[model samples]
Target: MRFTTQRKRFRDLSEQEIIALAISSEEDDAQIYRGYAESLRADYPASARIFDGMASEEDDHRARLIALHQQRFGSTIPLIRREHVAGYYTRRPVWLVENLGLDRIREEAEAMERDAERFYVAAAARTTDADTRRLLGDLAAAEAGHQESASDLANRHLDADTRSNEDATARRQFILTWVQPGLAGLMDGSVSTLAPIFATAFATQDTWTTFLVGVAASVGAGISMGFTEAASDDGELSGRGSPLKRGLASGIMTTVGGLGHALPYLITDFWTATILAFVIVFFELWAIAWIQNRYMETPFFRAAFQVVLGGALVLAAGILIGSG
Candidate 1:
């Protein structure tokens, strides 16, 4: 009962706290847009202009908030953030932002404006002071107007060719950041783990032993691949992301890929486990092929042939080696 009361208190924040949170959030978003603009200035000049416009808007909002704060409370405002509120939503990191497609970024921008509008509207409703309420209402209307204004700004800056190029660039970055590492992990897990798992299965002819071997192989491959990927590239030229994040994503996916087949070995019958493992392998290969074609822009037939053929060769090698 005491714990429930404390949780309720943690969940509810005052109007002043909410206002402070909104101010901090807007400032952070403005900085993020500025960073994006700077990063894209050379390759996507048109998109940079859009971010510049957004940054200006954020600056205007911040100025208005500062004025209001000075009039209402004091000279200095306390630093409060989204994390201070128990249930507040958090923004995505800048590295992750680089992977978003143009259309998705536009949609996200629109959503941000809408969220700001809603926050202002709710704040206005909560305020008891007439001046504060009026100011908040005005801000809400401004936020609502931002959605259309952003679209107009984007259209003015970005011609069809520029938009298309930016989209293509964004897609390429997505592949480099996420798909390539993930594919490497999946391939390593699915192929490399096979020999150790199968060797133990044949050697012991015991289901539990086989399962243990499979788990060990899957986990070991995941750690080795993760560290190797992280250490191999510092991402200076690639612009993928932090090596740690990329490594974690790749490593986790790799473990999952191997464990999918390995878990079936717990069935206690060699033939049943073997059949299930084969089925999982087939699905894994198809998934890899699809990802290559869809995200990496590889031709469907070529991607299919390459992935399936390579996977088959790896599978054959693992079997031959294990048998020996």
Candidate 2:
């Protein structure tokens, strides 16, 4: 996916073409670093400063590479880049990378340095010309130096306390944006649909009919829950993060929770499907308990007791009602 084309091999490039490619690569890297800086500027200012420093360093590298190109081959640089070179590493779009997390962005920055260094080393090996080989070796050294510089840059911008706080804040944001909403959705879907689903199952004694009812219950509940969560808070005041993200987490998990038991009813045999559905319901209740224990930090046994007892009561009620 990273390779757009394999038209030009590394060994095939002339010294002038290689210089042009290096210059363009530096320019693109600088632009990407700047994009990262802009992306993290608001929430994580310290991290943004680190990226800003990196961007500035990349600009300096580009300028140096351009000067070298001018001195060696007289200014009219060729339009060569990573995409033109076979086996050259390319950068992921900044917008996409930034969406991963704070830690991931930092890792990506480090990876960029390593990728550049490796490319330069590989280019050096491919070139027969002494000057070009040496030039590439120097470029490789410069990229390796960037790793040290990045450490110094981070030290200047991010103190231990600040880094710890930023990481904690990011974790909290993740929990608020995804885990909490998803847990709530899973709980609602698994517990709320039990009565109607089981009652219909017992009453009809028809696997196909039961499956239909279960699907309707699950999907309807999922949609209602998703919209309710999204509309409940805009995340402006609550600090829960994006409405869209929370809605997606809630909606997807809600559907999954209900479908766990519902899917078992697809079997043609009535008793077989019903037995499987019951087994699935047992696991769903336990899973809800586990999630509560894990993320919500509820006592495991207490959560299990509450979930299992409530589910059992509901199931019993459904069976009694169906029998009558």
Candidate 3:
């Protein structure tokens, strides 16, 4: 409640404060675009150049806004920011934007311009003064033009071949950083846990004991896989991206894979629990095969055959040992 009262309402802000807010917002946006450019510079140089041009355009807008502020209210502009104004659009921090993939960054930039245009249109509507209304209207027009400018810049920098190559690189990076590690973790968790879980189930025929084992195994495997993935490579040399993200993808998927079958064991009836577990195992193996075929480019039939065969052998071994 205290924090809510601290923000100045948009209607309450004077013309000078609005202009000052615009200037600060432009400055912030330029810095964000520059950060995106810098982050993408190494891998996506063409995209980086597009962000550089956008930042330059933002600088021009800032200069124009500052000039207007000086003409109207002397040199000392107020330190008003978007945060100070209620109902103002907020930008994501540079660090957060920097972590996004190339395609996501592009989408974010487009959304930023769209948000700015909408804000200006709303501001123009609220102001009674002709001069302030005209300024807001012009700013809206400028923001609307930014979309065209971005397209022109992209056309100049990113030709068909260049765009295709960059897209391919992005896809490869995604597979390496997320899909590969996650798939491996899923496979490990699903296949490796199968033996112990089934063996314990058949050996004990106790639903509570089986469920406990499954939960313990799933959690332990998840933790171990997470640590292993994080410690395996720094991603600097391999270009696999952040180890933390990779580790999270691996760990969460691993836990999920183990949990898929384990959940069936929660059923009280022994035969019913065992039957559901078997059904879940079948689906899990098929899902893994589908993922391999879809992302890893493995042939569908071949992947299915391999996964199903391996899983069947494991199942048979566990059942036999437990029945003995």
Model-by-model lDDT, in order? 0.76, 0.87, 0.90
Q: Tens digit of lDDT per residue, candidate 3, span 138-188? A: 989989988889999999999999999999999999999999999988988
Pairs that collide in candidate 3 are none
Judge candidate 1 at residue 316 and give its lDDT.
72
TM-score of model 3 (CA atoms): 0.97
- Cα RMSD (angstroms) for every candidate in the order listed: 4.5, 2.9, 1.3
Task: Write candidate 1's Cα lDDT for 1-324 as tens digits.
Answer: 353322222225454554566678779879878877786787678988998999888888788777777777765677788666554556677667654555666666676788878877886797787866876797788787777778889889988987888888877776776788988898788777776777666666677888888898888888988888899898988787668767986898789878978898999888898888889988988887788778777898898888778877777776676667
**TM-score for each candidate, following the candidate numbering:** 0.76, 0.90, 0.97
Alpha-carbon runs more than 4 Å astray in model 2: 1-7
Candidate that would win on lDDT: 3
26-105, model 2: which lDDT tens digit per residue?
Answer: 88988988888888888899999988888888888889888988998897999998888878899998888987789999
Q: In terms of TM-score, which candidate is stronger, 1 or 2?
A: 2
